[model samples]
Target chain A: MTRPAPLAAGISAAAAAGRRAPVLHAEALQLRFGAVAALRDVSLSVAENEIHAIIGPNGAGKSSLLNCLSGFYRPQSGRVYFDGEDITQLRPHRRAAAGLGRTFQGIQTYPSMTARENILTGFHNRMRTGVFGALVWWGRVRAEEEAFTAKAEEIIEFLELEELRHAVVGDLSYGLRKRVDLGRAMALEPRILIMDEPMAGMNPEEKGDLARFILDIRDANRIPVVLVEHDMEVVMDISDTVTVLDFGEVIAVGTPREVRENEAVIAAYLGTE
Target chain B: MLPTGVLFETYSAEAGLLKTARARVAVAALVLALLAAPLATGAYLQGVATHMFITLIAVYGLHVTVGMAGQINIAQSAFVGVGAFATARLSEFGLPFFIVVPVAALVTGAVSVVFALPAARVKGFYLALTTFAAQVLFPIIVLGLPTSWLGGLVGLAVEPLTVAGRPMNTPTHMYYFTLALTLIASYAAFNLHRSRFGRALKAVRDNDVAAEVMGIDVLRHKIMAFFVGSMFAGVAGSCMAWVLQFVTVESFTLFTSVWYLGMLIVGGAYSPIGAILGVAFITLVQEGLHELGTAILRSGAQEAGGAIFAATNIALGACILIALIFEPRGLAHRWQVLKTGLQLWPFPHR
Candidate 1:
């Protein structure tokens, strides 16, 4: 398999100096629904191969931020750049084709499909087969399908979901479905993966497993992750950097320890002073 | 699930169409039975079988749109009309059966794309209404054309299908033609369901927003769904023209489209076999009711003719309603249950 092109156009010496270029850059994003502002001038950057957590209390626009980055919600103002290319105007699928992948706040696996099929869908953009090729099922389409199935199996193993690979996703537990969703996103082989509330309803153990997977995604897969998570302990434990949002605005941006000790983040999470 | 005691060591084995030895034998026997049907069957039964195969093809077309891609296509019959009319025109030009069929499919597929474009902007009831407009518009367009083009409401007479300079108009020949085409269509559909293209469409059906975010290009796939569907309809329409040797607006009606949807529901929209089963059940029921209606009229119950005539429609509606309420997944799921039971007979349950 060919390596994915670096998220940034030019992974320069400056980037190689441990000060990597931001793979995804959000600039002063402002989103409004009717008269209500969902996100107000929220800007954050996710660097190469790092877990950048977007954390905040309810209605703080963490999800809105992830939505903008993932190209779901078009912000009223501000631009999103990936690999130095502006992508604010790209549609969700286009952005996905451009190597942006995401998981929904709600699990979005094709319920009737098996876990293997669900994960295989994540490789949608990568496959080169068209309608005729798929119908005929030979040559390029066949080879690519075999390769991708192998890749999907590898991801299933990585997530420890080999047993659940052929199981219908709808019949699986919520936690397993969530893992399947992640595996699907991982199949996209995204340059940067954005997840919405990966551990929202998980038990502590499941949360731990998911957090480890997120870290492995960053460190081992070398893909940057933009995680919108609410659990503070998991956030602080896994995040290389944390950007705190409060009422549609970015209140703090720093390392996990810095954000945890920040006065504003404490106030936002635990009632204002 | 893997059949009771069966295990697959390779991906191909796991993904094979028939799993256990029993399944292979059953499929083989079924194919042999179908192939030898003409030998045992008379002309009337052969015609019924031929019509069933044609409806099976059409219903499978509807399945691709309504079942696989989750698009509601009320214009299915209209697209079929596109094929029928195109075949009428192409056959009029002295094209061979083999050539005319594919050309009809292509023409209908293109027309389907026109109908499908509205799907890029709208869906559900609104999308259904959009295709409904096509359904309303198709017959008018055909009848409005110059007699030289479409023959108006009188319709056009189709030339006999020929292969290699030999007439294929006999019941036996037509049966083989329909069966061969149906087999090819079913094979293509079967492969498509497991292929990347089909999976992408199924993803779109399951959740369009999720499919889009996953980079499936929902609009493109929706268009593709319509194309494949109408292409199937086109092929079916070609077969229909061969069966009737006549093309008329009355043959392709809005009611027929609805009946096709009913067939998909009864058959299990997601399964090709369900399409066949649904077509077989619904067509046989309609024929049975037709005979009943005739018998009622002959027995001096002339007034009951109208009621008996409406029985087919009522029966179709009831079948759809029952399937939706009690077995929304359709007969395919039920078949799976039965197969599982058989596979694990002594074991009782999985």
Candidate 2:
């Protein structure tokens, strides 16, 4: 039995209407940096087509949880499972190869590269061309490159980045660069997309555009999104399942309205007010 | 760039190497002229052109390592020396220059990886020091090897290059051979920039953390840049050895490596054409000024001419700085700007 979707009036991702097996999950993760515990026994699961949102106050271990799940940080005692396979020991790029796509908290794009080239690099794990093969550029290599270029263009088209295709990302506005970062992650064609504060600093219009793109990605691409966001409005508007974290531990997990009313989450945010 | 009003429906057409009729015609003309110049030029000019070809290939390697991959390689000339020594030893086995060149490149590339192993882990000044260690070790290792191996103090003067069982020792022969290989090396470097390897390399260069999160193995791509860059230098070394009919460690010193980097900077590092333009521009300036100095020393106005020529030497030495001052991106970037102006004619600003 699942909670009612009283707030699921917007997006198409059902709130447990037809939930499948979890596509990505972190089980009992415990990460420590020296004496400080960044995450302790944190666990969460994301199913297909679900927009799973992780919301927390600053210093609440949201990044640590995302890092542990994305293979950037190894939990001292836990396991990460994707498609029912444990991938705890995998490195970041290795996990990426296994379809773990991620976007950083800031504008972490290839500054010197054009917007399109930046997105094309997101297809790194998908393609199989090596140094020699790429250097030689035979028929097969050219074909592979053209196909990647087309795929990258598709991402650019969806992001409405046709004009910025040739512009170097470093020269673009901050909002545009953030959008390019998202487009690049989309270019990975990840089964489950993990975004770290995809809208940390943005104008209202850019935030609306990115939110729309996120919904389009879920509806059209069928990729589940695990978003670590500070914006409560955007989180409540998009997320199907909400997990509230505080001080390196999960405090509450439920639907948006349920977590919004949860006494612990209220205390964590407002502190006995 | 396409014509002002032109548009392409396909990405392939938009990304074509020669997108315009003018570029195609220019490439054809340049090829025809290069093939025809050897016939019309004197032996001295041919010899100088052959030398420029060697420098071009070396600079191409630097462009990849320093330019695209953002790996600082001041010891590229050391890698070139490794290639030369390797080619000399390979030639003693009586293989043709064709088989020998590729093998020498691989040997040099592998040698570069030894340094790249440490270099790849570091960045900026530390990486420079790592490559510098390669340069510092090159002469010591070469000299420390048995005198019987590749001639410690004394260099190797192997057999001349052969084609159809005949020694091709003429300047024209050397020029044509170096020209062909230089073109091939250029093509390979160009293709590297166009394809996925280059994108990955640039990604690592611009931001390694971002690159890693994007599924690129940053360390591997950095090492790959060094390996491929050294291979180009190795091919250049092979060309240098066969053309000069000798191999000497002195020919590829740290000073020479610095010059190769200088050429890459002058040409612009990001593109293959920049390598060519940079190498040719610097070579012409140096050679032309040398010829003028020699002429002035023998002229009627000896004292004044000598003073003027000495000033000219300082000016010529400062030309690279001057070029950088005017066009910080290098001559290739200036060329791009000019072409963009051509594409956007009737409007001076872009």
Candidate 3:
């Protein structure tokens, strides 16, 4: 794929600054559920400020890979490195604290909470005030909460979700819920963001809007994104690199155009269809 | 447009103290009324009310376990038994009532932790069975063991409690004492629900997987809840022993645990109001049945009176079944629905 001129400039500048170490790296990750090996020998790396996409046919273990990275599943054998630290055995919230944020394919919004409150739950780890401080409504805790609230509001405005800030997540549409889920992950202010099928159930218009938002997030925060999505058009448009998986194995890895033309990628999709 | 009423509404939502201004006022008024109940009621009613107050403390403990923590316990009466026996034994040595009560509560809380061990590994019917075993074992161990402290099958007599050299042997004094303790216990339980630990417990109850994912230690919270709940039960047991001036194995039977569980279901498991309401309703019903039996016997229907007394359990069983089927959420939920309806009067949205 032909890289965008500005993105190529940014990449070369980062490379010049000695940004060779991957922000997140997974090596030979394997997971087994009973008789089925959900993932086998899966390896991937995400560079700083780049949009990396993982795409495959159905049952390619895309979700399983995301789960392992997010600390939901412990692989039988593998190591995950985040920010140059080995975080293979860290718990989910600990990983989140270490600047790793993730959103689920299925919406996991707390139904009883408003959009703003749901996002605030993501900021739980960042808030340093103890229980006593919260109970007394001390000055420092109030200031801290106010600061986080302002940040969350900025994220809401960026996502164009200000109108739905006070609305309960249960009452929102699927597309809106997806955006709210993204807002929640953003509240964590992670250095690396992992999105699992952000456009899975959105219409074409919604998909375009989310794609623009994703790009804006990358530009504004300079945070690398690891996206697992099936939308080929989106993958081609936004991704700096694309990896194709087939039955838990990485079959192809290159620029979007290169993967699109690979014989192995074509064969994997053809056999499934 | 600049924000005016919008800011006010947002402020109210963010306040997180009760839900509305009216609720604040209502809670304040209720507290005042409870403080004045002893002055208004007669002696016999005061005694009955004091008993109700004690039972409410026990019910509140069960509420923490079954309602908030989502753990079924049929062993609360066993903890009560431990507390009651502990109090009696201590009082026999001439220990003050205040000293005995707290000591009993702690001992019972510790015993509850023992019963809660199986809860870490089992749930639902299996957990209930473990508690049931504890309930049965309490009576057998107390009665079978030839211990002078427990007084064997007959039990021990308690010394009358006194405040500032004035003995509280009268029903009216005991009523105020029990009522004050009940208020403190209720306040503590309600405040806990709003605390971080309380929210963690509720999170564990609502969804253990999600709570664990959120980094809450589910096992630790569950066990802590059991300890707190049993501590409350211990207070009730100690108070009951003091009020009656006696302690016996029969008083803290397995049947008491079953009745406490029934009270939790009838009153509504999650609400503190439900705990008090359930206790009041169950106590009043039992008293009413006893009165009816007396009236029947006095009217020369001795045989029918015997049958009516025998059938009381059947009636209570039927009420529990019906309440479970029709109002599974309990009376507390019904009360909330009513309150919300009144607050948002002329608008039907909940």
lDDT of 2: 0.86
Interface RMSD of 1: 1.1
Which candidate number would show the highest TM-score if scored against the true structure? 1
Q: Put down candidate 1 lDDT per residue, B210-268, tens digits, no spaces.
A: 99999988889999999999999999999998888899999999988998998889878
lDDT of 2 by residue, B1-350 (tens): 45766577766667667777788899889988999998799999999999999889889999999999989999989998988888889889999877999999999999999999988999999999999999989888888899888788788887788887888899999898898988788778878877889999999988888888788888899999999999998998888888877877788788888888877877888788788889998888888776877777777768866776677547655766876787767889989888888778887766
- List the global CA lDDT of all models: 0.86, 0.86, 0.79
State the lDDT of candidate 2 residue by residue for A168-210, as single tens digits: 8999999999989998888888999999999889989999999
Model 1 DockQ reads 0.68
What's the C-alpha lDDT at position A99 in model 1?
94
**Cα shift from native, residue A14, model 2 (Å):** 15
Interface RMSD (Å), each candidate?
1.1, 1.1, 4.5
In model 3, which regions exceed 4 Å deviation?
A1-20, A49-52, A91-102, A105-227, A233-241, A254-258, B1-21, B85-106, B140-160, B164-166, B347-350
**Cα RMSD for candidate 1?**
4.1
- Evaluating just chain A, the predictions reach TM-scores of 0.91, 0.92, 0.90
* Model 2 misplaced stretches (Cα beyond 4 Å): A1-19, B5-10, B300-317, B323-326
